[model samples]
Target: MFNKLDLSKELTGRRALVTGGTRGIGAAIAQRLLDAGAKVVVAARTRSDDTPAAATFVAGDVSTSEGVEAVATQALAALGGLDILVNNAGGGRAFLEGSWTIPDKAWHDSFALNLFAAIRLTNAVLPALRASKAAAVVNISSAAATMPFGPFAHYGAAKAALEYYSRTLAMELAPSGIRVNVVSPGVISTPGSDEFARTTPGFSTDDWTRNIPLGRLGATEDIAEVVALLVSGRGKFLTGANYRVDGGMTAR
Candidate 1:
């Protein structure tokens, strides 16, 4: 049996689900967990040719009722029951002028995708989570929730809500041996982020690095490492926390 001093196998025999796990930060998180010895299930609306081979793929959208149902059913069946759930399926659509020019549908869609999907998926898996001896739920938020740059205002707003909801989930689920937390990543250099940086007015990849205290853009693995820790036995005492893996972006 492994003990706390053993870093090599903290999550052995665990079963996990990661939404949007086919690409970007989500893919990195899925890979990290697999490395930690967890049985991983990756959920996405579509399959990618580059999707990690170690994970079992469950194609479905997490933003809709039917999609959520599909992912939940598939995950439960595949994993038997889930010991970890990562809500990583949310992102932004570039709409210039943000709050000033964005349409109602954009705001609603943002909430549906970023906030409500987590809520629905979490609710769907609660029973299984309760049954587990040790369980965790990690919701992927953004630095924008606190930093609040306007171009992705709706995304930020939705993520802010998710952070709040995640804390409450922690409080309610703690008694049942389930820990819920939030991971807010800053400007990571993913394909989607690279393009967003290049096109979003004054922002550029170089400029973003200059502003960050780390003097570099973050990699998807940077965020993944933190998530891997949070879902493992090392995080047994942690719950209701919003972890910012932002390279000190918010410290300034």
Candidate 2:
């Protein structure tokens, strides 16, 4: 069934960037894109203290304007031009607090990390993305954006903003041939997720798997494969769309 959509080698000669690429979904996407023949640059505030062999790492936080500038400068220097940009760098654990208990600073901080980071990075690299034939932006959103669990309201709100922003950018950039899209994933199993699993009350592995119609917690590859398709030529005509990798979570 999948053979008809081969799309193999569709990413050859392309240059890709994956923010928060040191681990989890970002790392998986970076590896897969490289396997498909795209040169990749992985960026985050810290290098994996563990994976020394991970993709060429560029150390820069996306929370500040200066950090954003550093990432953009390093990326352009490494790739000469940018083709596919995957904004995949972010995570938050504070969810039990009500909106009244949530500080204004925390809410704004979440937006900085989850929403504004992608916006600043995209803005800085617009020129390079504009210069490429396959220029595209892939914002990694969350199923929570729609689900909006009470504890993680701020995180969900930011992701929701990301989804809307990506859609808006798609229309504005469509005339310029720059495609912008979003990938909304359900919970995926990763090292970053392990702590969430252990700490988040009642969030057992079994619970997560059972909640999904597919009956399994997603592997990083599960999300990575879809991302590859979107950034590749196979998804050339796709823009302003949210491709959900959630295991029927949002569908429910």
lDDT of each: 0.90, 0.86
Alpha-carbon RMSD, each predicted model: 1.7, 2.0
Clashes per candidate (backbone, < 3 Å) = 0, 1
Candidate 1, which segments miss by more than 4 Å at Cα? 1-6
User: On a 0 to 100 scale, what is the lDDT of residue 221 in model 1?
Assistant: 97
lDDT of 2 by residue, 1-252 (tens): 457654446678899989988888888888888878788899998887532263678889898889999999998899888999999988776657555666778888889999999999999999999999878899999988998577778889999999999999999999999999999989898977877888887677888888899888788888889989888777889999998997887788
lDDT per residue for candidate 1 within 1-252, as digits (tens), equals 345365546778899999999999999999888887889999998878657899999988888989999999999999999899999998978676657888899899999999999999999998999888889999999999997667789989999999999999899888888999899998899988898877778779988898799999899999999998898877889999999998899889
- Which whole-number lDDT from 0 to 100 does residue 170 have in model 1? 94
Clashes of 2: 1
* Model 2 weakest lDDT span, ten residues long: 47-56
What TM-scores do the predictions have?
A: 0.96, 0.94
